[model samples]
Target: MKKSILKWCMLAFLLISNLAVFAQGGTEDTPEPGDGTEPIDSKLIWLAIIGIAFAFLYFANKRKAVRA
Candidate 1:
């Protein structure tokens, strides 16, 4: 009976603490819209993805050859 009461007390404390955290607003130093940043090149991104795919295929074939 004591253990059950202790568990309920701990659970209620945790619930109240979480509600207090959620009630707060964001800080004053948060970033505003249109913060200056350049976009990345899509061609370079695609080239890196293709290179990774080729590497995976090469290793898979090498492993299969070793098994045979």
Candidate 2:
């Protein structure tokens, strides 16, 4: 149980960090695309991908649980 809680805490920390980094928009390394002024935001795309992955996993687990 302690290990599980620790794992969840780490996962939450990583997710929050990723969100903050993504929210900050393009950095020096990323630079601006063609405009050279705007910072492109891609959090929505990231969110969509995460949502789809979560759904896939949920269904997969449900199926496994049903089978077992």
* Each prediction's whole-model lDDT (CA): 0.85, 0.84
Residue 24 in model 1: shift from native, Å? 56
Tell me the tens digit of each residue's lDDT in model 1 across 1-68.
Answer: 99999999999999999999888576677566558532356468898999999999999999999999
Best by TM-score: 2
Cα displacement (Å) at residue 13, model 1: 68
Positional deviation of residue 14's Cα in model 2 after best superposition, in angstroms: 30
Give the count of colliding residue pairs in each prediction: 0, 0
Best by lDDT: 1
Candidate 2, residue 53: lDDT: 100
Worst 10 residues of 1 by lDDT: 33-42
List residue ranges in candidate 2 displaced over 4 A.
1-41
Which 10 consecutive positions of candidate 2 have the poorest summed lDDT? 24-33
